[model samples]
Target: MQRETTGLLSPGTHVVEVDGLSQRYHVYGSGPVCLAVPGGPGVIWESLRTPALEEFLTMVYVEPLGTGGAQRLSSHPHGYTRERYARNLLGLLDALSLPRAYLLGHSHGGFVAQYFALRHPDRLSGLVLFGSAPVTGPEHMAEAGARVQEFVERNEGQPELPRVLAGLQAVGGATDDEQITAALRDLLPAYLAHYWAREHEFKAWRETLTCTYISGLDEDLTPDTVDDRDALPSLGVPTLVVVGRYDVICGPRWAQELNDLIPGSRLVVLENSGHLAHVEEPEQFAAAIRDFVTETSV
Candidate 1:
């Protein structure tokens, strides 16, 4: 796979200044609006860039705070909280003069989406949660940790993946930036159903994933205090909950919980994917969004 082309990677972006902070989002395609909120708290939406979704809707990727020069100006200790992220998203819409738009969030971004839907149900036409969880911070981390243990136990031969991932905890990666990235690479396979079968997608993602300012933003982006377990079902908006069959992090457990809690929500398990279903199955992923947006736009 020749990866030199930057067709979808590069897109025109418009930055909106709110409260002395700049919120930037890469805009692509032209159609009904769909805001793409990325995960990793610190990881920018650039990591999840895919052109397929743009084909169906005008895609706007909202960068997480402290990314792409959009530095955070907040003095709050929980500056990276999900509430802040959701507000920033709403601010982006206001800046762009969009009354409402479709919201698609992956992993941690999914948490932000939930809060946004809960906080401002009138501002959303539809919602998509891809490989995301609906649990509190402690439960969220426990779920991930427990699944990691299960992954190691279930996969008999891949003893080295977890071992290398453990080394990421030491000072070597802490002091050296490249080591941190390399260690993250070692953990990528666990997010895929079959590493060897879809190594190309993982390799391509690894080459592009970068941790910038607010590197530890993921530390505070969890549902620390914004658990919407009971509130989600009342959002009363069309929702799509998607997960990869082998996504250990946000596996079937989270998917079922989301589907069960959100009334009239559609759950789709991408049979051949892991954490990055959009990367593994972009066409199908994009199609699902298209159909949902279309069905709900009446």
Candidate 2:
């Protein structure tokens, strides 16, 4: 029943084709499973790949529909919804013979994780919500505007500061994919607690990841994730919500909401981190996940 090769048994990344769609999963490590979902909804696995966590857990970096190597089966606008994303996660688990595994969702991926927890709680051993939120649309747009203004005020010397601010406002209302990607580049600096000014590192990262904006995904993400005030608290799954103290995108306020709502979820706010805590503060990030997985697996 397995085409050319669907499940594991390789060192490099591989694809799982089932029911007219293919999901690319980058597998690492050899212990407890942590199905780590990358943010950006379409960003490369590289951004969310954790070498540190792999030392303690089997990390499965998933590329959701419309991102990286993933291919969506349906062209219907409704096909790209959050529930569809959750279904793919569930399908991947079944294809791998993984009855259940830890779900770690970062940024927008956390939204997908939350939906998965709601629909398929029985298939999750635990859940990790990293640098994510409970509600994001107009409020998220407002947050981005505020953050950009704050940074632009102090960084007037940077020639592109004004342009970045313009781009921030533009990305939210972006109609086409090109505008969205350009806006993503303009707003990139705000997500970093460190290396925001490190031109070399920033440039290299931008070059490699580019402006990973997947068309139609913005529609899929924004409108669907309404307030989770009632849903999160009811979740019986063990949960961990990790955030960066300086991450204005998801921010501490949103993280607090998640921790408070998710009954027994543990919250870890790294002192020296922003949007990408796993990259910004690897040691602490890995340690927290290691401890949680160990305790929960027991």
Candidate 3:
């Protein structure tokens, strides 16, 4: 894979100042722009490298307010509401001078993407959600907590694993910068290999995680927080819901429900993959997205 920077904007990370926050985004490639929202409130833009995706769409990966290179609004620990994130995204789009573009979101980013679609449907050409659930119910959050507990238990006996687990827990409720960075670096390897194949490009992808926070379970969006499922049908834009069959985090069932709710949305479940289907099955994932974008663009 050839890696070259497209100087679409200023050389380094550019901050888009919004109300009480500044969102950071990386602009790369040149074609139809696709804005990608990273998973965590703390995850960075370059967590996943979509080599296949860059072939078609000019990808813009955004670090949410207070995540990655973005500036934090307050030192006080607070969970972000979906509306706040959606508005931040709108502000980012406006700063970039993008009137209408495809929106692609992963994990928690999916929630932000959905909120954007609901609040500003006029600005979106399409919506793509990967390993995401429309409404994370209480049961789902409870299950997620259980999974974290189980992961903690399984790795407890190992010397280094305990530290990593503790760090991960810290990430869930951390407000301090040092704690978040430590949590991110500790969990980097497993996360990288779990998603990408062992390749040179994979190393580049792994490097991006150094300053990024992978999603936080404490601030997850559950069913009770979501207002309406009925609004999805009227979104009008073409939608794609992709999930991993082995995704314990979001799972295939969540994608099924989203597919059912969104009119003209296509659902694809990759059998061997987990939550990070795009990384686990890059080629297949890319082909599915390419075909969908092509079909819908017509």
TM-score of each: 0.85, 0.88, 0.77
| Residue 82's lDDT in candidate 3 | 68
In candidate 3, stretches whose alpha carbon ends up further than 4 angstroms from where it belongs are 1-12, 145-175, 181-224, 227-230
lDDT of 3 by residue, 1-298 (tens): 1112233343345665677575667766556778888775566667655878888887788777666556754532344656767888887677667778899998888888888897798888889988788676686677556655544554455565655567566666655666676676665433322332344544555444644432332244222265347778777778999887656567776789899999889999887666666777889988888888788677
lDDT of 2 by residue, 1-298 (tens): 5642224723468788655688888888868777888776556677788899888778888877766557754553234667777878888888788878999999888888898897788999999999988987788768756755665665668776666667667765765446666777776666767544666756776555633455434344444545677788789999999999878688888899999998888999999887888877889999998889988999
Q: Pick the candidate with the highest lDDT.
A: 2
Q: Whole-model Cα lDDT per candidate?
A: 0.73, 0.76, 0.69
lDDT score for candidate 3 against the true structure: 0.69
Q: Give the winner by TM-score.
A: 2
Model with the higher TM-score, candidate 1 or 3: 1
Sort order, TM-score high to low: 2, 1, 3
TM-score of 1: 0.85
Better of 1 and 2 by lDDT: 2
lDDT of 1 by residue, 113-220 (tens): 998898888998999998888875678667877776766666667656655347434312343345545555666667777775656646777666764333333344
